[model samples]
Target: MIIKRKVNKEVYMYSIGIDIGTTNCKLCVFELLSLKLIDSYSFATPKINSKYGYDFDIEALYSQLEQGLIQTINSLSYAEKVKNIVIASVGESGVLINQEGEVVGPCITWYDTRTQKNLADINQKFSDEELYSITGIPIHSNYSLTKILWIRENCNINLQQVKWLCIAEYIAYKLTNQKRAECSLASRTLAYDLKNHCWSEKIQSAFAINHLFADFTQSGKNIEVLTSTISTKLNCNQPIFVAIGGHDHMCGSIAAELKPGEILNSTGTTEGLLLLLEKVNFNKSFLTSQLSFGKYVKDDLYTLYASLPSAGYSIEWFKRTFSVTDENFDLLIESLLNKLDDINYIKNSLNIFIPHLRGSGPPKRNIDSKGLWYGLGENSTLADILLSIFQGLCFELKNTLITIEQLTVTHHPIIKVIGAAAKNPLWLQLKADILGREILSCNIKEAVCKGGVMLAGYENHYLDKNAHIQFDNPIARYIPNPKMTEYYHQIFADYYQPFFEFKTSLEFKLKKDN
Candidate 1:
């Protein structure tokens, strides 16, 4: 049992949160007393060797963080008020660090598709069921172990001289000079034993990756104090605690006020639907469908994550390709929403789209599946086409949600949405109507970053032991329109399902013929 401490209102404290994403990195400063965001900074993630594969310059990311950290710290009136710093990052991407604590190579991006060849070799070594049982992750190329093996096979790096560190761990190492792998990020490696909460000896021996991983540490565990060098660089007097925050989605879910029966829909460049479970439910059918189960930040909970790799990216693609004027994205979104008011017009029109521009994510891991726009007539307008994308994406999420409900024997009629897409009222309404559920907008612009702050506060004992740091009351709630919900039910049953089944059949036939 844990003892609760009484609050001290006289003391003032602050914490810093850094979230490293696929396309951007965000730094947030939170005032611990009020739990409010004081200031923030962000920069686009720099891509390296774009012509070959998607990779990030780890050094560039560190430089941005260093500058951002100093700037944010200077903005605060009292430097001593800053208490701790926590780092959160996207999974599956990590850097190889040498004995001298130097990055040996670029951090491979999870979006990179260069490890397909390594997948077959890995599959031959361990069956999918065995891999999923051990790691609680699907046997996919978009995992750190596969990418690391690919680099070893292709690059001139000496494995004996370096150890693998996830992006969050790399950042923590830079701040405190401690080589530690946070449990949440470590689970993404597809080399961790979820049951034992350590690196899987079977996977390590099979891949010869023994002694190439950092010490596995629990999330929210304070590993090191900020070094004097970092404190001097930031012009700070306080000794900051450096703690580990988990994967961005896990953090986002925490920020979105995750509950036992609720799901968090985090929509940014990509869209992820996360559900929290108190215990691990290792279902064979679920694992076979490629759904991932990993450790959540809370010790008692695990996360089931399903994603659409190109949800928002595909929307941006459509806007870039079709917009005639230099209209702002928000303006385009509002215009599209206004046009969606005419329900009968949309129903009469036959324009339809499939939201798989970057391959289908889970339940159907088909790399060859391409996005399709069908039944577009001469009467179809740009708004109609845009609405189709929204419909298709919602349908895709509904399918994923259904699978999750079946596998877990739980029902989440409402999903809390966060990030950029949560700011769009129309998108929220559409999700509610199509999914036939309520859409609660949490309105957290940088939930991933906020989650990092919350974790830091929890670790430092600034937050209440029983109270969750996430927003409890949603800023807005969207209820489904009965008519729209009914229509979408029919459309999903008659149109989306048939088309998806046909696409799967065609893809399989082509592969067999080849």
Candidate 2:
């Protein structure tokens, strides 16, 4: 039998936020009166097992979401209080060919690397700066534009009868029957103009993409109300307001209270290091503002990001390859910690690692870049090698931070960190030491979901000092040691020089061969 909690009569209204991530989908309900977290639920993303390639099942995904939302509301004391539902989704991965108003194909994921050749061809035809100027996103195979191009070129599917949609937009359409793409997701498509805040006609002309793309809308704008069918499915008769929620990274940054001179570091399947700035234009020599989204306030403030493709993935790969004996994650973490403790000679070791196993991401999208382990000899053990890899990832993050600092002229001494990797004490300490910045670890690690909830709260008039959910003091702060910071700076300089050289050489050779 299912039990339902009793709710206080005073707090009768609530806000809901749904986050659709690469690995999971989560729902969070917050009291509209107090803006406090009331209930939450999560489900693994439904994937179709295939011999040829992996693909997400849209029907299964919607089913999971439907069930998860029902379960989430049922668990709450004031289930009927929920009046607003906002969704934040992983952008670039979601692609569908919509004919009139129906989905035609499985939503292709951003992780799928099947369009490498298409990406190469597109890049060759259009310069990187031109693409960035048009779409505010670097040319990459992970983008929906290239994936759509791939489908058009390879498949017998008719491209004339479809409207492309991002995952969030599709979910919104499913919820409200109104098709629109949020600015945050649209910016990642390599088809939206950052300055004009609309679909780029020049880009569409150059790529020969369909003009039936979904309309772009700003986040937090109420588009529609829930239908009787959706209300019945959730066992609620209350009106449900549908508001646009943008990219996951942008939402996560919002949760962290990201402002000028503040950085939000998200470490999940991949690490996304983002900065929220008031200005859009920056010097072209170093970092670029690849994407921007409307801020919650009236005046313009955009979330600019630089992402690393392999952060937590590096740790996952290491765990799978090295810690076969420990099936439980707690035990694996303990084993890793114990191994690190046992390494007495690591204090004086000069090992270095470069984690480019699946290739590096932004400022340079080097597909051929391979992971490297330098200064490895007979004395190196699995534990030592693991430490090197961990440090290597930190070094890459540090390099990115340095570049951002140089280009943007904004230095954030403290970084707000969220996601699964934030739980790793070793990694956090390493990041602090390498970047020479204080790392503020969030108590509630699910910043993306919380950000969405915050948006819902704002829409429902429930955000203030009295709100239970506040992004103030960090749960823990990792401060860098002066001596260690100095040591790392010297090592970082040496490591970065060879790294860029290697990337340049690889790109040159690939171009020559092609």
Residues 1-514, model 2: lDDT tens digits: 1322333544477777788877788888766555556777888877775542456776788788888877887777666667778888887866565566666755677766677778777876788777765565667777778778877776555666777878877777788888887777877777877777778888777776656588866576667887778878888877788877788877776676666777889877778878765656623453243333322221256656777777777877887887745356555455555544333454555677777777776555565667777778888766666778778888878777776777666788898888876678777877887788999887564677777767655654556624445543358898987777777788878765586667658766887898
Instruction: Find the number of clashing residue pairs for candidate 2.
Output: 2
Q: Model 1, 1-514: lDDT tens per residue? A: 1222123323668888889988789999888856778889999987788565878888988999999999999988766778888899989999998888877766788877788779988998999998988988888878998889988887788887899999999999999999998878888899999888889999999988888998877687778888999999988776888888979888887777687778899988889888877777677988867798888887567878897888888777887798635366566578867655577776876555778887787778765578877778888777667778788888888888888888777888878899877877878888999899989899975788787777666666778657755453457989998888898899889988888888878887997898
Root-mean-square deviation of every model: 4.0, 3.8
| Among all candidates shown, the one with the greatest TM-score | 1
Q: How high a TM-score does candidate 2 get?
A: 0.88
Candidate 1 structure lDDT: 0.82
lDDT of candidates 1 onward, in order: 0.82, 0.71
TM-score on alpha carbons, each prediction:
0.94, 0.88
Which 10-residue span in candidate 1 carries the lowest summed lDDT?
Answer: 1-10
- Misplaced by over 4 Å in model 2 are 1-7, 48-54, 120-125, 208-210, 286-299, 323-344, 348-350, 375-382, 464-474, 495-500, 507-511
